[model samples]
Target: MITKEKILENISKIRVNKKITQKSIAEFLEIEQGSYSLLERGERDLTIDRLLQIAIFFKMDIVDIITYPNKGSYNKENEEDIKAILQIELKKDKKDQVMKLIFGDNSLEILNN
Candidate 1:
């Protein structure tokens, strides 16, 4: 189950890892930084459209944004760990897409397996 809280938390990790500020995301979303902060803090309910917009801004699939690890156990710096999580969580086609997005040319062998 993809809970809103998990989605927010995953995106927050991505944002922090990428060194992107709330103000940058706020500007991208055309909303106030305070509003973005509220959303990140889970005080505000985010719409699916807004979430998709954020995913687009990050050049990531919405599933990748929302598919969090079990009990929130994950290493933000480990791409292989994230890929394994995504592989477990995603269906075949979506997994293929995510693999391509993450590893580009190197995903071929993984996708075949």
Candidate 2:
């Protein structure tokens, strides 16, 4: 499951890791710093379109924004899958633990990417 706090933290981490300033991100997104700050602080909720733009800017998926798995209106099977992935991603253990739990050997592709 993804929370606003988690989303904000991950976004901040990505920005810092990439050595991109908030102003740079704003320029890329063509949004004002005030507006961007609100979004970062979770004081403003991003529309789906805006969210899509942000994800594209970061080369990330919607999954990264989600701090927690949300079953929402999904069917039982989908809900179960989300739950499983959440457990795998959230569980803190050795590096291989996440890979083994989430995708078994399928994470090899992710590593290469």
Candidate 3:
């Protein structure tokens, strides 16, 4: 039920956030760069095994890379969206600046040490 577009978007986001090139992911996945490109473009499908490796690479839950089959993918309500993000940011302890940017307060239980 996951959409190829969403998978591509998420992969792009993760790679860019890490400042990694397709070559890097290809290397990380131990695949040819061209194959990785095809995968990114949805010309190829990601197997569960490869997806598990990606999950470990990103240190994320498998469900993250796999887009939910639910319809209306994006959150329409601002409050619900913000709350969900705050919870994740808090749990991940991503960064003080990012947490502040999202929640406007750095007093979260998960502090940047």
Candidate 4:
């Protein structure tokens, strides 16, 4: 079963990897830093909306955050499948916007060329 502790651990790892500070995240969430710290330490319960916001801030799926520190091997195929589904679900303009943000204007140029 997924635990709050596991989710927080994943959030911490992702934050560190991305060089994002707790204060920055707190600012984004419009919450007090202490409250954010409490959430990170598992001292406070996280709401689903808050979790979703965190996932969006990290540019990750909520499932990835909740399923962190997986015991088994990573499932690349499943991840790819999910990505494919998301791409199909998103509208063309929105998809292009997301792709530009994730990649860059140069990526769009490459695609067009």
Candidate 5:
């Protein structure tokens, strides 16, 4: 069973691996730094949307995030496979929509480059 503590531990590991700070994540999520600290410490409850946002920000699948063991490492191959699958599954229009949602008006530039 997945526990909040496990998720928090995974998030902290991922963040550290990515060389990101809690303050950066908090700013991205538009939440207070103290609130974000509580989240990392497993003292605060996370909403589904917030969880999704964090997963997206980290370029990870929600399932992977939830199931990842605290001491385990990230699977780069799996992440690449997921990206390829997304590229294949998302139709041009749908991809555009998703890119717009993720990158706003810079989606085209980001996709093109």
Candidate 6:
């Protein structure tokens, strides 16, 4: 059931949710904005190499992109990996804020201890 179209939709959703422009993504992929538009619009084929490029741009695992918000591979191991990635990308104070957003108020308190 996980068609290429579905995968494209998931990638598009991530880009939009993150407020990333198609032009920016296009530049990152070294393609024209119009071509990137076609990809997001499902008018062009999303090749494996391009998908891997996009995943790198987003600092995400391909599995993370395919499963996305539901995060099908999000077991304890993945959780730790995700936290480590976030730690590198975020400042100490910002990490707590992000953890709070994702895990509720008490989560940060527990994490800090």
Alpha-carbon lDDT, every model: 0.83, 0.69, 0.72, 0.84, 0.83, 0.86
Q: Candidate 5: which pairs clash?
A: none
Model 6 lDDT per residue over 1-113, tens place: 68888899999999999999999999999999999999988899988899999999988888888888776655746565664343357887887787888889788568769
Deviating ranges (above 4 Å) for candidate 4: 69-113
Model 6 lowest lDDT segment of ten: 79-88
Taking the candidates one at a time, how many backbone clashes does each contain?
Answer: 0, 7, 0, 0, 0, 0
TM-scores of all predicted structures: 0.59, 0.51, 0.53, 0.60, 0.58, 0.64
In the order shown, what is each candidate's alpha-carbon RMSD? 12.4, 16.0, 14.2, 12.1, 12.6, 14.4
lDDT of 5 by residue, 1-113 (tens): 67778788888888998999999999999999899999889788887898899998898887777876432356655775664333347888998898899899999999899
Question: In candidate 1, what residue range of length 10 has the lowest lDDT sum?
Answer: 68-77
Colliding residue pairs in candidate 3: none
For 1-113, candidate 1 gives per-residue lDDT tens digits of: 66888789998998998899999999999999999999999998889999999999888777777774332234445755554332268888998888899889889987578
Error of 3 at 64 (Å): 2.3
Candidate that scores best on TM-score: 6
Full-model lDDT, candidate 3: 0.72
Looking at model 2, the pairs that clash are 1-67, 1-68, 1-69, 2-66, 2-67, 2-68, 3-67
- lDDT (tens digit, per residue) of candidate 2 on 25-82: 7878898987888887778886777777777887766665453234234454566567
Candidate 1: where is the Cα deviation over 4 Å? 68-113
Clashing pairs for predicted structure model 1, backbone only? none
What is the C-alpha lDDT profile of model 3 across 1-113, one tens digit per residue?
56767877787777787787999889999999999999888788877787788778877666765653332344445555464332343444556667678668644755645
